[model samples]
Target: MKTKRGKIPGFAIQEMMVVLAITAIVVGMAFSVLNLVQRQMGSIEDIYEVKLEANKLRQSLWIDFNRYSYVNFDERKGQLYFSNELEEKNYTIIEDMIFTEKDTFNVQLEHKAFYFKNHEKKIGEIDAIELKTSKESGHQQIFVFKDNAPATYINHKP
Candidate 1:
């Protein structure tokens, strides 16, 4: 008696097409996920840059606002000039870049302005002063200074 050998099986064209289609689907899904992650990372980076720059501006301004005897702003020059009895310094913006006397950073600020409130309606009786930014208006809230303050408005410079 002789024993019969089993035949080697091979995949048909339809079976091969099915495998290829499945592979394509998996690879396509992977690529889509990768692309989404990259986009998210870029967005996160942009937001972080904006925040970092804004913080720098706020910190520098806080110091200047406290120390200076006077404060002023120049819209065309994009400068916040601060002054004392002896010296004058400034924080200027150029080409979306902010520059202090010693440090500089890039930001997306669109506007600079000063607001004064005169509830008493008397000459040299300004009760409040506000330094505002356009892009992130929350950076500077309305600051109420004391009445009869010697810090008189002098053309937007401090």
Candidate 2:
């Protein structure tokens, strides 16, 4: 078919197809970019969550260490218990999560580890702890607790 083009304000089939193809390409690119941005945002959120958990762990540990006369970790039970002459408090790490006594509070922490130093250590006192947490998004944090108590080391619960 002979096409006439003289200010008729019309587009041929080939031109329309080309335009549609370009539009589709642009839309596809936009969607892919959006997907990448979404993934980055999710990564950022995961990192933020990990940071919050680390802060909570540090603050809680500080309070527990100060308030109690002694603190110990039960390796077999995966529980960290702090006690004095009368009151005893405990927290258990289960399936990469932390659970506490009294209120059954829980925090999701992936790849979490706690290391303790007891009186037997050459450092002369049981006054240091290490906490490490990591996430699948490659976010990792390590917090170390120094001996600040006045020659105090709490006993582990039986």
Candidate 3:
């Protein structure tokens, strides 16, 4: 090989083309891998969002179940009431959503069951609740329970 400068030798045109081609191929492969990783991250983000929503719903229900001494539900009105000695809390269910005084949860319910002392009840006082929710990934079941009913609550006739 000879250079245009006549004294110093340099890379030939064929060698330069080979290096450029290899660089382009490597860059192309890197871009493809990056694209694949980006798509996977997007999907993972969506799954995390779904799981977060589920956890929020579960925690809220658990807190209310444990804090309240009395729990009641009106099936016809789609209203759930939780009460202690001082304050009362209400939860309303309409369609695929659950609404509280503070926030609303977008949960698609597949089924719901209420129980009092291990006996299933349709409408009225309850000690436990089971919710079967539907999500994009799969179905999930959430159960919230009150440990012991207050004597006055259990004795009261409603």
Which candidate number maximizes lDDT? 3
What are the RMSD figures for all models against the true structure? 6.2, 7.0, 3.6
**lDDT of every predicted structure (CA atoms):** 0.60, 0.63, 0.86
User: Would you estimate the TM-scores of all the predictions?
Assistant: 0.58, 0.60, 0.86
Q: Could you give me the TM-score of model 2 versus the true structure?
A: 0.60
lDDT of 2 by residue, 1-158 (tens): 99877786799999999999999999999999999999999988987875766676667877777778766666677777777788988878765567776433234445444444433332222345654455442344545455545444333321
CA lDDT, candidate 1, residue 84:
73
Q: lDDT by residue for model 1 over 1-158, one digit each (tens)?
A: 89788887999999999999999999999999999999999988877776776666666666666677665555566666677788888777675677876887665444433544433321222233443444542343324343223436444332
Query: How do all the candidates rank in terms of lDDT, highest first?
Result: 3, 2, 1
Please, what are the lDDT tens digits per residue for candidate 3 over residues 25-142? 9999999999999999999998887777767888998999889888999999999999999999999987688999998888788889999878888898888999888866236788
Stretches off by above 4 angstroms in model 1 are 1-4, 69-78, 83-88, 93-95, 108-110, 115-158
Scored by Cα lDDT, where does model 3 land?
A: 0.86
| Collision count of model 2 | 1
Residue 93 error, candidate 1, Å: 4.2
